[model samples]
Target chain A: MPEPEPIADFYAVVPAGGSGTRLWPVSRAASPKFLHDLTGSGRSLLQATVDRLVPLAGEDGVVLVTGAAHVDAAREQLGLADEALVAEPSPRDSMAAIGLAAAILQERHGDVVIGSFAADQVISGRDGFEQAVREAVVAARAGYVVTVGIAASRPSTAFGYVRSGAGLGVDGAPSALHAVGFTEKPDAATASAYLATGEYRWNAGMFVVRTSVLLDHLARLRPALHDGLRRIAASWDTGADARARVLADTWPGLEKIAIDHAIAEPVAAEGGVAVVPGVFGWDDVGDFNSLAALLPSVDGSGTKILGDTSAVIRVESAGSVLVPASGRTVAVLGLDDVVVVDTPDALLVTTRARAQQVKDIVAALRERGEDDLL
Target chain B: MPEPEPIADFYAVVPAGGSGTRLWPVSRAASPKFLHDLTGSGRSLLQATVDRLVPLAGEDGVVLVTGAAHVDAAREQLGLADEALVAEPSPRDSMAAIGLAAAILQERHGDVVIGSFAADQVISGRDGFEQAVREAVVAARAGYVVTVGIAASRPSTAFGYVRSGAGLGVDGAPSALHAVGFTEKPDAATASAYLATGEYRWNAGMFVVRTSVLLDHLARLRPALHDGLRRIAASWDTGADARARVLADTWPGLEKIAIDHAIAEPVAAEGGVAVVPGVFGWDDVGDFNSLAALLPSVDGSGTKILGDTSAVIRVESAGSVLVPASGRTVAVLGLDDVVVVDTPDALLVTTRARAQQVKDIVAALRERGEDDLL
Candidate 1:
């Protein structure tokens, strides 16, 4: 009935990256997936991410780590203070991004517990999300690197899987269990078999750990990268000149590694990782088909529209997804399970059955040297 | 081989109508099918029709019959003089449009043998078309209402069929034959059966007859419509004011009947009609499927584009008809036999198998009162 107050000493780190090549024209390199309102909720995914985090981390406790090119857009959309926006000079992948944020929090806020969430994910059921994050914070306080593993509703091969072992039997977290290991995206048969076992959950890449804990693990696992990130974090809050000098000197040399591989998997192998079951509905909106799944069906025919419903006209076309972003009328006839995304500069036509192949279109565009569209 | 000289006393009547709802977005009511270049041949279909006819009838001998709303575009595209353009106040179907043209040509040029060609049809093999028109004109001078019947290439259920009787043996027109009867668009089974007998040919509605003969037949078959057309024709050349007033008064009262019902079927039944075999390639460009059939394939995969080829990017889609009229990049992925039309104000997505049902989208648009899009 009522939302819980902000957790004390908890900070959120939103690492915004990825061009979403499968989503194509809607998610261009110039304006990526996190900046788009894929859910028709009137707020971009980045803003929605911050909105979800503010209840747990408080207004001033959330920091964003994004590319230097996107810092202005991130600040404009989130209305974050300069100190709260960490602009990466260039992409060194997730390990450097999340590690730098963790080290900087350790420097400025004295080893506060931090949770890393992606800026482009879609989640529903606020109570379940908050509850999962609360349990994750509890495990983090117990000195375990915690991950929020989403309930596997279907045998989907689009995401990695995290296996749960014995229950943690910890005090404040009843849903916490020992995370045995992590696996990359598997084949359909393997995913189905994984679903058959009740021990697997979708590894949504949500990690909550003390800033000092993550830094210490990074120092032992990837010492060079960890030392480089610590060097950049030392001057992050000093002055513009010193911060720019440190970022220019150290960020380029950091290792390009995902947090899952560098920290989650290795530390997970040592039995120091814990998993909290997240019953909330979640999606990364990786493709147009996934974005369609996030939208509410507009009619009894299962037609989904991301933009103005009145702009779409369907005849004998059931289960169609239409995004009319150019203020133009979209008419779909005699086609079932069709996807039509009509933007100003580009239009995409495909079927839901073959939606995963849309990345091929982007590749084709790239091969044709149509960089402006990409 | 050199081309033939213009035939003496031969005039051409071009009727440009039909919204082509099946080719929506590319063929809107404001700029119907004839105004579009469905073949990507630089010239609009109306211009191509006139280019084909100018050799049979002299450069100044072609008359265009179209709605008053489209007269300016037709004139600009055809480069025709004011007297060569016949603008109807409103649509009264094919009979009034063609009959009025006949009456006007009779008043101005005196009993000239005229051939009626739709402005939207695509034809190939110039020598074959010229030979067919030459034979039809000879039969028309012999006092027979003549029609050029396209050789049925397939058992297509999309068009009407004409049955040919015994040969006419008319001089200078060895290919002319007596017309038995005409059948409306039939079912697939009926069409196949009709093709099995070697007598049926596609009725393309290309009529060649002396103005006096057509008027006499119209008067005998439907006197009221003939009188109304004659009344409009008499004032058509009097003055602009008188022409407009007469059209407003008489055109609305004319019966809305197709030439087939009003003359061709009745004349054929009475053994007064003749058929000229058209062996050349021909298509009405009736829908996206037919349009695809007319375009040259951009690749061995059978993908067809009716606009700039560079504007379309196809991946794993075969036999797709794409019209990128909006100057936007259109990417189609993993769809076979799909039809995508991207225009400035509207878009259409469908499959070639369902191309005939595209008119249902127009109906849906009208039901939504989206007249601007239509």
Candidate 2:
């Protein structure tokens, strides 16, 4: 089969943020989840994210927006030009990161369709992912704020839900539907109910839209945030000194809100949002449990090993996830469905059921002033 | 309270052996359980063993029989004179270790009452322990092999039980009784039944007998083993050169059996064994669960820490045993009764219920040829 051609005038905006606190030692504030090879695929989540997008939006068409601290690391991984790598002075959450990238893409390459995908996510089924993105881009060009909602594989309470309304009836984007609204992570019963109705899909926070349309929506909904982003983008191409000055002056003061809250929710309510069904498998790898789900069982008994398989010696421990990142022997005996993450300086022991509470440990570490460990 | 005087001619024999397979990573063959302070006490189990014995058998009267590899470490910790530190060329089980200590004590200081105490046991209530030893010595002087039977706090199937027959009516040893026989680690129902009998006590393998009496019993019971111990003891006083030569030649060929099988059971059957009630708190710290019980709860909820408290950040985890021996942060979240042993080379994660099965992990490691970790 012939490879799909790169979409013309399309830009991939990778807003890399979130420390992935539940991942703890593996995903730190200095080097978050996006920078690590969570799937043991030899490529980091960020690099893999770019690898998937580069085919859809050519190498030069991809733009990365991440914290300034991670800029060098991101560049080292992707080898993206300085102009293409947009470094945020500090975290202003997803909205600002995505908004800034959208405005910059518009200012540099007028009115292009920019698809904002998170850098820290594990994805599989490359053809399906590319096909979904292609359809989403087509929907975006139709002047709708498009979201590629993942098929509800399970009633997961870990992610928000995007409810699909009527079909968009757009040409070339056959799977696209009008997004009704979005719901925050629901309780088990509510999530199950939503999954039962064939309308809800996991809102992966992927927004594909015309750069002009996103900026226009932002101007009407969040005028202050849009104006700040516009000001920064205008100075982006006026040399490194000017770009730094503008970012330093404006980045920190921008509104700190997720893109879902700022754009997806409000726009969906206005009937301007579209949901494209993503048949591909995807995960944010929220914790060790989610990470375990992404990794194949090294042993037949549902034991998942993220690092060197030989480093782990498991005995009667069914469904145990062991990350022997420290190159030391990790032995799990008679523990079923347990998670043991071993790093050089830190170790984590918990059950797959309690993996969501790992963030509590991070909070405790923070309260204990163990910032270095965090 | 007035301190008890050292019993005349009473020598304390500390047999420090056992790889403590169940407590692997923390207790390797090179560094066994006796060398570690599993109780969170400043002193090691070996040091604490000698400390408790010194009051009964003056500082100079304590003899530590350990593997040759651990001799330097034992000496460094105890500052024992060269004669008091009896280093075995190789392991030949509890019988060889204790019998050698007894035979050497007889060869050097004549027929003194020698008490055999395992170096890896944890004990509390020094007064109660000393009182038990005093009574046991009295019974030992009556020409019987006396054993200190610990007050069975629970129906533990982990330890052997000594069933008492009738009162010995010895002068000073008022509580001493004629031991009927010894039962190996029993089933749960059997242990519960034994505990209800009021005459049964947890046999902690503490034997107090006159060196001459023990040798006589060994001679009558196992003549070849008795002759071999006597031969090794004869050369023990000869210069280091001659001692090494004899040990190299005879140690390998000696019978490898536990003291329980060699003398305790046989002597008890022949009505030469006496049980002195030991009201002192004691534990073998056989596994992580037992070790957890020995350690004081760091949290109100049964969480036990063996190393630096600050290194651990536990959340919603009760009844967990954490040993952060590597000076690294160990975060345990939402795992109840879990055992996480973090060392520099190896890590063990299991549930308290499965702690006894940890030796299986060690065996698996040995199968994998991870000798360094062992």
Task: Please name the candidate that would achieve the greatest DockQ relative to the true structure.
Answer: 1
Q: What proportion of the true contacts does each candidate reproduce? A: 0.99, 0.96
Clashing pairs in 1: none
Model 1 TM-score? 0.98
Q: List A-chain TM-scores for all predictions.
A: 0.99, 0.98
Error of 2 at B2 (Å): 4.2
lDDT of 1 by residue, A14-39 (tens): 99999988887788998998999999
In model 1, the runs with Cα more than 4 Å from the true position are none
Per-residue lDDT tens digits for candidate 1, residues B1-374, read 78778999999999999999988878889999999888989999999999999999999999999998999999899889999998887888999999999999999889989999999999999999999999999999999999999999999999999999999989999989999999999999999999999899999999999999999999999999999989988998899899888888877888999999999999988999999999999999899999988899899989889889999998888988888889999999888998898889988888899888999998888988889878
lDDT (C-alpha, whole model) for all candidates: 0.93, 0.91
In angstroms, how far off is B264's CA in candidate 1?
1.7
List RMSD in Å for every model shown.
1.4, 1.8
Query: How well is each residue in B99-213 modelled by candidate 2, as lDDT tens digits?
Result: 8999998998899999999999999999899999999999999999999999999999999999999899999999999999999899999988988889889999999999999
Model 1, docking class: high
Mark the 10 consecutive residues where model 1 chain A has the least summed lDDT: A284-293
